[model samples]
Target: MAEAGLRFGIQLPVQSQSTIYCEHWETEAGPAELAQAAQAADRLGYAYVACCDHVAIPRRLAGAMGATWYDPVSTLGWLAALTTRTRLLSHVAVAPLRHPLLSAKQYATLDLLSGGRLLLGVGAGHVPEEFEALGVDFHRRGAILDETVQALATALTDEYPEHPGPRFPFSGLAVSPRPVQRPRPPIWVGGSSPAAVRRAARLGEGWLSQGDRVGDLSAQLRLIADVREQSGRSGPFAVNAIPPALYVGEPGWDTGRHALTGKPERLAEALSAYGALGVTHLQLRPRSRSLAEYLEQLEAVATDVLPLVRS
Candidate 1:
């Protein structure tokens, strides 16, 4: 059964062109198409619209990951100006690559400007070469990410934040334009590893799973619950899932066997299963051949699929 109030959001296309998921049509699409999709999400009552981050891609991995990765902070800032209601998300900003204060300065300004709508999804980055290029220790990324999250919590909440960490330490420094969200915007930890799950439980306001299978998520959820309970943390924590590639109604083209296709009710039933797994937020990727078809998919999700899921 679908959990009551299971919220959904889309990963805005044309921002990252990873060969793993990017449609052929997205190759020809650009900013105007991106804006239109975001605006539609805003108008249609999606909870958030998310963008991915990558400082730069090496030629070695460029064939698969692509080279069109947009800076999440800049893209989200632009989306903030374009939409009024929908929250802005980084999907997973690699925080360890940059100092927490620098991130805090940029994100705090974004939250203030966006009227308190920011979900800072952070991850310990995977690409070692990118880390090397930026002078961040690739092997120590997990530890660095842990400290970075702690520092970000303090920096986002306090104008004059202090951190005694070894790698990035500072005190008595003030960052102006405090965030609109009280005490700071929500930080969502992203990744599916054991350490990442624990990090999300201990520090994040939410957990953004990196495409973990539905069958695998229950164990992870149990792990999160155990960690939070042991740590004596008490508050609402958002649990997220990314469902199979979605295409509302029957697709005239191949959507692959992994995709959830057909009528609104069928799609709703499958999606609502995430809610049953204790997932509170869903990241949806709609398959399309062109910009018009993409918009149509979004519309179908909002008008037909969401209502059934909600009910």
Candidate 2:
């Protein structure tokens, strides 16, 4: 929970340019712009900065996905040095793409170096060609991911962790510079598929749901609750939601019909409904054509919007 209202984060622009959500300015932006955005998020009190992961974008998806994915570990680790307080998240790293030890080492170093501000959000992944390119079985990725999650749970926390699994087994190998967080960073499983929800309830600290329609969230929440209850998970768990593009203040021009546009007060009232549904965190992606406009939106949220809505 944030000091004021619900905790919020942004999938920082200029990192990943997925056709579905990539912004206009990102195509031309670089580290200078990314750092500026991250630093502003930290200074303005955003909860965390998140980045997406993809080893490669196959030619088929290249047109829509622009083939520009900054490695999450490297991006977040870089931002970790630039900002002091904001948390770091991988949004949804495809864990089945790499061995758990490699992932653990990279993330453990990041967490330890950054004073334990890493939240490892992972997914089973969907890109078949990328899996093929990496020599991982696309059909078995889900099972592979399940095992990897168990392997990470051990590797991230123990100095000499042992994981005897179907693949990637180890008994005596020790990893240096363990994560600063005692049990390692919190893992928020991504995706809203049946397997994803179940994996989150059974293994993760939270669920970063994949854009379940607003009308359907109640059913999904109930399902999560049922699974947690069945799995004996009595501890706290975060349920996340990502709303469509938002234009905080009235744009007079044409912000789309789905865009949430209004005075700060109106936005607050509308957003408060999310809290009623038990959403612990909300990831906001403001509509912007330039870095300056984006930063202005962040400032507006920090000064005007957060106060009225944060609980």
Candidate 3:
């Protein structure tokens, strides 16, 4: 049940968090672990189960972040199969990586399989190496993402769907199994750029602000507002901010800017401040010393951090 005036969401970091974690466990959450995480999140009343979509993180983050990349759609389909209530979402699937028509079909299939639980988050991918791996032109990916969104919007419609898009082209093919969500499954545009803001306003239900500065977010919000107003849209749009890496010990915490890094009460205050600014969702990546530490942090977040935000 949704709170009277609040909604909370938790994003799962599906990427490999370990250097030696087996490759087979990369995609599926090992069956038992997936079940446990899903059951736990569902039991705790989290609204959505979100995941990141990356073919691979840049070489620089090989040590800092994990290497194994999981397919979010397939993983979400599995999550949906296991969990009943939690809506399945991808933080941002790289749009230029797949055929828009194919993605539409796949998501529609997933939506049907999940009983209409899908929030399709799309983005113009940033990694040039991944694009190279896929044989896609990295230079043209932004344009491809733009046109991909348009093609998707058109394909998800009921009426005559025809798009002579530069990235995707379809004449009169009936793209079957349209998304269960009316007017399409709540497309949220990701990335923090003027172009991204414009793309979100022009073709999205909201903006997915990932790994950005507070000043950058404020400016982007302003740009979103201007674009939305120009396009005759109104208030109550969402902005889900992914705060900076929050560690347990940081000196002189102000609690005004970045999300808190210390106690639950402090983190709660930071969440509340974002909420006060009309931020509907706060997605945090827990700092972990080990797998044990990750689970400990997740437990604390589920028990202590989430409740304060909920309140």
- State the displacement of the C-alpha of residue 136, model 3, in Å, after optimal TM-score superposition: 1.9
Local distance difference test, per candidate?
0.92, 0.86, 0.71
Candidate 1 on 262-310: residue-level lDDT in tens? 9999999999888888899999989999999999999998999989998
Evaluation by TM-score, superior candidate among 1 and 3: 1
* Cα-based RMSD of candidate 2: 1.9
lDDT of 2 at 219: 76
- lDDT tens digits, residue span 1-311, model 2: 21123787888999999877877789999999999999999998888999999999899899988899999999999999999999998989999999999999999999998999998999999999999999999999889988998899899878899998989999888987889998778888998888888888788888898877667778778888888888887767887888766777877766567778878888777667777787888887777778998899888877887688875
Cα deviation at 74, candidate 2, in Å, is: 0.6
Per-model root-mean-square deviation over C-alphas: 1.7, 1.9, 4.9
Ranking by lDDT: 1, 2, 3
lDDT of 2: 0.86
TM-score for candidate 2, please give it.
0.96
By summed lDDT, the worst window of 10 consecutive residues in model 2 runs over: 1-10
